[model samples]
Target: MLGILVQLIISWLILRFIAKTSMDVLGYRINTTRLLLCVGLLLFTTMAALLAYALRWWFGERWGMNPSFSLLLLANGIWWNIKSVLFEELIFRGALFYLLIQWLGAKKALWLSAAAFGVYHWFSYEILGQPIPMLVIFLLTATAGLVYGYAYLKTATLYAPIAMHFAWNFTNNFLFSGGQIGKGIFVLLPTDTVQVGYIAFVLVQYLPLVLFFVGNYFLLKRFGKVYVGKQHQAPQL
Candidate 1:
């Protein structure tokens, strides 16, 4: 609990500072309400988790897989979900990616930021003592990063990507199993059957990119130009 508290404070302070600095550098004012962004992100993430859970329940029943939920488990699940959303967004969406855009051109920045975010996952594998599987994971994670990077770039707000990141984590961690959601209590597929390094794993990892493409298309249609110049005025909410 102390560790979590420390993480929360450090992440908040660091990201808040970074956000402010990036705003100054880019001359892009924050037009949207931060509270609204937080709420919207929470709602979208909840919806995605519920959708994945419902699907898992349906399939698990068909396949005779037992998925259980209890009060304690539910509490832990929520804690982890919130932790993931807040900390991950602070590092990837809010600070690193935002700074990348300010330093590099937006297009090049996206790839660089995504790679940094994706490769950071190796730390997790090392902690778990799992196989590195560098090549496959890199491609997959990088693809996910691209989708997330593109979203933030287009919206010029951290809200949408943060929400999407939260949703993806919640769904993948506690909803389905294997590539779909994850292998939490709500797991759909038992881990034994799912092999890493297979094409399916790569596809599953990169699935968010497909959503990114769709979101990017709509954003482009609505916004026209993709890059936000320093002199361009921020739109009113």
Candidate 2:
């Protein structure tokens, strides 16, 4: 937690220095529209995740809800997830991405930021000794990063991606109990057993995330300016 706070502060300072402006210039401020968008995306992603879990359960995976709920535990989980994800977005999609846009064009910036975000997870996943293939994990995280980057690019606000990131993490970590980091408030399946094949498990788990990414990509392309044209200017709050 201390590390995350330190990283966030450093990221804020670096962004301010690089952009020659306040944090608002990096889309840190909030507004009604962005808030609404955030909420909508949150709900959408949560529903999508639940749907995936349901499909898995239907396919013979056993699931059971926790018998008791603790408000304190839920609050702590929310804080932890939000804090961790916020620090990441501020670094990968906030500071690094802003600089990349200036150096490369927007189109290049998008993929570059996404790739960096994916690569950033290599160390953590390695330390965790994730059973999934490294290449597969990299591709999955990179794809998620693309979705997040696209969200930031289109909305020009951290709210969209932050909400999406939080939802993804909260759903997987808290609601579904399938996350690599953090124990969930509820357990979706019996922790004692693995019911699905590893490859099938990965597909079922990540399909919604991939769908959300592809869906957002199209939405941004059709409705938002995702490409960095010559006339494009840096985003402002």
Candidate 3:
């Protein structure tokens, strides 16, 4: 936990510096709403986690434990998650996706960024759980990434995607027990425990997230700015 906290602070400072430097280089004005967005998203994440915990207790016969506000108050825990949101936003959203948008174009950048984000989780699956088939989960995660990326592109602020990420993670970790209908660290759901059928397990577990992405494709396309416009147009000859 302390380790996660330290890592998060380092990530936040690094990303903040990067944002400041990039803004100066590009002559792009700073978005003052960034901090507010972060706070709003963090709060939403907390609420969603609590909601999920309530649902699990009501329907799934899970422990009826109230969501821990203390966890959010815990210095390291809060820092770790906040860092998770900030660092992840900085790396995948701020840096990698931004460059990809400049080079490959926005649509391609969005999809490619999503794909890379999904693929990056391979290390977690392989190291943590012995190389399980995580492609399904990754795909869903990628789908979520698309929405997040779109949010960032639309708002030109880190808050939207940050909030969405925090909500999803908090729900998954605290309420869903890291299980959101896929092969994950948690098995809070009924179908998550099937030992023999891995494929069935994955499909049953993470299918909603997949559908969610598919349904949200339009929003992504809309906010993501699929067409290269004057704002991002090539230099005139």
Candidate 4:
């Protein structure tokens, strides 16, 4: 918790120094329209992920409620996930992203920010002893970062990407329980058995992410113009 606070402070300082603006310039303030858009994206992405899980279950994937599930634990998990994602988004998409865009242009900033995000996951995955290969992990996380980065760019607000990030992480951790390391509150596949195919696992794990990217792309196309060009300017809301 202290670490998260420090990270937030550092992020705010850097963004303030580099962007020459208040924290609100980084899309901290929210209006009704932005609120609705964020909520809609959150629900859409979460539902898409749940749909993928349901499909996997229909195909004989075993799912059981976590016997150890506690409401307190679930609440704590939700708070932790939010804090974790908030710190990440604030640093990667909030501070570093703004600086990179100013120095390297938006195109370069997008990929660089995503790459940085992917690279940073190496230490955590290693510590967790993840079964997936490092390169594969990097690719997967980088892809996710791209989606989040694009969402930030399109909406010109942190709320969209933050909502997407929280939904993706929370759903994977709490609802589906099939993250890269394959642990969750709700088990989608029995880890003890070797019967589950790799393809099936991939579909269950990554399909929603693909849908999120595509779905968000269309959403932005329909509504992004209103928020466009507001990212670098003073807070409008």
Candidate 5:
């Protein structure tokens, strides 16, 4: 799509002209060992996300068969989720994140990414200016941004973050039909959907995110540091 193309061009321009580095610094390449690592993390994070949705059921909500479900729609939803995830990862964690690390060091850069990601979601998720949703969304997405940024930093590759992001979003949008995209593999009828008390809601909502964010943060920490693709010296700023 033209939008994605323009974003790619913008990222390249930032790397080429502003960062004074080539795309090589992005480390957007494949290595067998790291690819396997990525795949493993991909499965791990996907299960975490799926289990998070499953927690909704534990709190009394129920799903009905999606009336509009079909193979064509499922395929389309998967592709759409891919593009959406790719768009966010590129915007948040691609070239600009690397440039930030170059200019500000990893700690500050990661915070910037986290803050920007959280605020950006305020607009994208359309909870802008609302108190509760805004606060919650910012905290959730910002924490996610930290994990994502760290993944990119430690691996020196976008693939790690992309796989995790795509896995989580795909589970929400496709498997669980939890997104605004359409009826996914299943749907919750309003009549069947149960609204629980604040305590139950908090447990169901925040607990899974805890598993996801905490799972990723520590597991990746244990994965150790490395370059995922072809070894190259960091671009000297």
Candidate 6:
């Protein structure tokens, strides 16, 4: 965490020196109404996707309960998730991304952000050279980056992208116990107990997330033009 803070501080310095921009370029501050709408839109899309999986995988009497459920741990998970989300958003969709737009246009900058995001996850997941897993992980994270970056570009705010990112992570971490964080609200059944075929397993694991990214991508494309008041004034090129 200290390392992340140091990197963030250094990043801020670069953002100031090279871009002449502050964190505001990431669009953290905006009309409260607009922020809420962004959260609502992204959350619904995210939850609907997860719920589709829950219906197929969890609620079919397949996934069981977590024996140990602690409110204290839940609190800790929430705190950690918030910090991690903010850090990633600031890194990927923050100043450097904004500058990429100035140098390259929104389309090219989005691709760069998407590609960097996909590659960064390789180190984060410690899957540096393994071909198969790295490829799969890259595809997933890169697709996510495109969606989130598109949201940022279209809405002119990080609120849009952050909402979607936080939703997917938080739900996976705290609701389904599917994340690296502590125990969540539910747990998946043991593999031995729940025997799913390879095709079913693949669908259960990846399909919903694909639907989510596709849904949000089009949603952002369709309605991201929305804004309210002058609180989120667009950044000048």
Checking candidate 2 for backbone clashes, the offending pairs are none
The lDDT, on a scale of 0 to 1, for candidate 6 is: 0.74
lDDT per residue as tens, model 1, 1-237? 565467546645654675554233221245544345535544544554454344434334223232565666656665677676666655666555555665665666777777877688777545334445776667666766776665565556655566567666665565443332234554344333433456545444344445444543454335432443342332211
What is the Cα-based lDDT of residue 127 in candidate 1? Answer: 32
The model with the greatest TM-score is 5
- Predictions in order: lDDT: 0.53, 0.72, 0.53, 0.74, 0.80, 0.74
3 or 6, greater by lDDT = 6
10 residues in a row with least lDDT, candidate 5 = 228-237
- In model 3, the runs with Cα more than 4 Å from the true position are 1-21, 24-55, 66-73, 127-132, 175-237
Write down the TM-score for model 5.
0.88
Candidate 4: Cα lDDT at 93: 89
lDDT of 2 by residue, 1-237 (tens): 887778767767876787665666457677776777778777777776776877777667675665655787678778878887888888888766777876787768888887887778887667345646667778888888888887877777778888878987888787766666445566665445557678787788777767777766665555444433343642321
RMSD of each predicted structure: 6.8, 4.1, 7.5, 4.6, 3.9, 4.4
Q: Worst ten-residue run, lDDT, model 6? A: 228-237
Where does candidate 5 stray beyond 4 Å?
189-199, 224-237
lDDT of each residue in 1-237, candidate 3, tens digit only: 465456445544553564332432111244545455445545544554455445434443344333343454344444445666666766677655555666677677778877877877766455335345576658666877777776666555555677677666655653444532222223343344324366654554555454444433443344333223224532110
Model 4, residue 27: C-alpha shift (Å): 0.7
Specify the highest-lDDT model's number.
Answer: 5
Pairs with backbone N, CA or C atoms under 3 Å apart (clashes), candidate 1: 172-181
| Model 3, total clashes | 3
